[model samples]
Target: MIDTTRLLSGHREGSTLPPLSLDVTKPGNWVVFGPELTAAAGPWGMSFSANLTPDETTGIGSWTEDVFIKTLRTGKHLGMDTGRSILPPMPWYEDLKAVFAYLHSLPPVKNQVPGPVPPDQVMKMLSTQ
Candidate 1:
């Protein structure tokens, strides 16, 4: 059976690579994406996975349920009414409560992920790709 506590907490006790500041050391989880899947980097530039842990100061700990729903529904960052679209490769839609539930249930990790690249740069990269 899956050790959900370890999986959800980002615990990489079995990983080969060293930890990153992006790693949560209290439990020591690595950002281990599968070999077939990769970090998103195309016309939209690069986007790392988000730190969904409930660290109020650094993670989505402040986002309300309404905001989370709006984010999925509108594809806007922080579910802002006018924020940038969630960007490519996300394949998002409405009614993401299960996802939110999983995220909110995790121990609050404090990793600060990078933001999206500028639109112009992404356009340039997309054209090249």
Candidate 2:
């Protein structure tokens, strides 16, 4: 049986896997999929997975249904016209009202996810390595 609690709570910040190398064609270089989603280091730099629970502070509890739908539909943070692109490997999908409803139904979890690191920073870090 799926542990809905852990699934909804997300993988949390400290549990995130280390940034993956860009050479995904290698045999052992596959991306890992989990409750925290996929964290990829590519041209876009590093993007941490979001906390999908309904926690008011760290999660999506404060988001309106419209905002949720628009975020997925438009791939903009908070669905604002001027908001930064939501970034990938987060895909934009259609028909997510049911998804929105189900996510909101899950118990709120207080996990705080880190934001994305821009490409320049990633390059700088890689150069120093």
Candidate 3:
């Protein structure tokens, strides 16, 4: 037997922050992370992971602290676009601050996961799972 409430709590909407999009880089590369996983997408043409690293050339170095907040606030690169929706199932609504807070606590690794699948696939992916 187990505590369903506690187990369920782990799955709560704001239980944690989503992936930070890292560069897959090479095969031998080891990404520093805890035991968790989620999906991320953007308009980059291919799948991409967030670059949490502080490296100015490769990671979020250029992103101001406000930019980090906007990632969740506007869900569109701090008003970078005017029409593109951030999509659902990812839950950008709810407590935007929670997500922002979680991401804020990360060490910024350069793991750049693939991003932004094709537009046509977006519908299929979102609709299916």
- Global lDDT of each model? 0.60, 0.71, 0.52
Give per-residue CA lDDT, model 3, range 99-124, as digits (tens).
89999999999898968889589888
Task: Please identify model 3 stretches exceeding 4 Å from their true place.
Answer: 1-46, 78-90, 96-129
What TM-score, to 2 decimals, does candidate 1 have? 0.45
lDDT, candidate 2, equals 0.71
> Among these predicted structures, which one has the highest TM-score?
2
Candidate 2 residue-wise lDDT, 46-117, digit = tens:
666777889898889999999998988888988998999986577675458977998999999999986786
> What number of clashing residue pairs does each candidate have, in the order they appear?
2, 0, 22
Positional deviation of 63 in candidate 1, in angstroms? Answer: 1.0
lDDT agreement of model 1 with the native: 0.60
Which candidate tops lDDT?
2
TM-score leaderboard ranking: 2, 1, 3
Clashes of 3: 22
lDDT accuracy of residue 90 in candidate 3: 38
Residue 20, model 1: Cα distance from true site in angstroms: 19
